[model samples]
Target: MTVHDIRAALAADKATVGTWLQLPSPDVAELMARAGYDWVAVDMEHGSFGRTGLPDIFRAIECGGAAPFARLPVAAKTTVKAALEAGAQGLIFPMIETREQLNQAISWAVYPGHDDGRAPDEPLRENRGVGYCRANVFGKDFDAYMTRRAPELFLVAQIEHIRAVENLDAILSHPRLDAIMVGPYDLSGSMGLTAQFDHPDFKAAMERIHAACKRHKPLMGLHIVQPDPEELRRQIAAGSRFIAYGIDSVFLWRGAERPR
Candidate 1:
């Protein structure tokens, strides 16, 4: 489906399940996309793929008919712009703690030219002049893409750090933020309860996130490291619209060990 379809689903509060692709191979990306994921995120932060490697993987994912997303290492302007230019229909920005940080990310993601006259705190309105990258079909479909597809580009703010959790309300208030994903491990570490998913502190943090997302407009998302169908269902029932279920490596390892 197109980015427009994904955006519509999120707007309708529909459950969209996706997988994490960290193997840095277009083949793996294509394989995962073909497996019927609603979306696939190219994990650049923790994965080995650099800026140069993203386009091929994105192409492969699109070829297999799944929307491609990029999980950025940093919320820098250059990183966000490059990823979008390379054909990421959506972006997962990690470690965003402040409203300013998220605002900047949205500005870089949506604005193609400098100073569209938006307020400093507001993201630019136009999605033109992104300069003929893979996203616009290498300039072949630039106008059509800007006017049609670019508006549907998804933007997700990752609530990982404790500070982000504390500032959840303000962060979620950003009108351009399309979704919010919680990083359980990082949040646990931030709370001084590293890897303790069952700890009260961790569970409470998750609860706070759920409440905040329900209070806001953006879709709630969770990254599940293991393929637990029951837990996935529970999260969705709890209002997690975007569910990122497991990484490529973990799935591969589990499949390999299943016969043993």
Candidate 2:
């Protein structure tokens, strides 16, 4: 499906399950995409691969008919532009702690004239660069891509710090923010409580973040990193709309460790 489909599903508040890709291999990408995921996100923030491998991995994921998404290491125009041009249907910006950063992210993902999530009366803040690339079929469909694809690209913000949690409501208020994914590990680290998911302070921070979702419009997402189906279901039942199952490495390790 396309970004439009993902947006519609989020609007409908439906559970859209996806898995993470950290390996640089296109074969793994294709296999995961064909394994019943609605989408598959390439983990640039922590993955070993770089920009050079993105296109083939995206193509591989697309071969299995799943939307290819990406998690950016940092929000930079050059990288963002390249990722979108390489056919990323969606993007997740990590370490976002302020509304300003989010607005800049919107600018990077969207073109120069469209107000994807801006107020009707507000001025357009289009900041995406235009050029012939894979997304527009090397400019053959540039006009159509600019008019449609550029404006409809999915953009997600990852709240992974105490400051982001404190600013949650304001962060979620952005119209251009398609969804918010909680980076639990980083979040706990920011709170001086790394990996202590059960600590009161950590739980409190999570509670505040989740609470903000009930008061906002963007879809809420969380990662079920351990490959536990029951835990994945529990989060969805508790109100996660955009859910990421497990990273490719974990899945591979678990399968290999399973008794024959």
The candidate scoring highest on TM-score is 2
Per-prediction TM-score to the true structure, in the order listed: 0.92, 0.94
lDDT of each: 0.85, 0.86
Error of 1 at 35 (Å): 1.0
Off by over 4 Å in 1: 112-129, 258-260
Steric clash pairs (candidate 1): none
Please state every model's RMSD to the true fold in angstroms.
2.7, 2.0
What does candidate 1's lDDT look like per residue over 165-246, in tens digits? Answer: 8899989988778789899889899999989999998898888888998898887898998889999999988889988999
Query: Model 2, poorest ten-residue lDDT window?
Result: 117-126
Instruction: Report how far residue 180 has shifted in candidate 2, in Å.
Output: 0.3
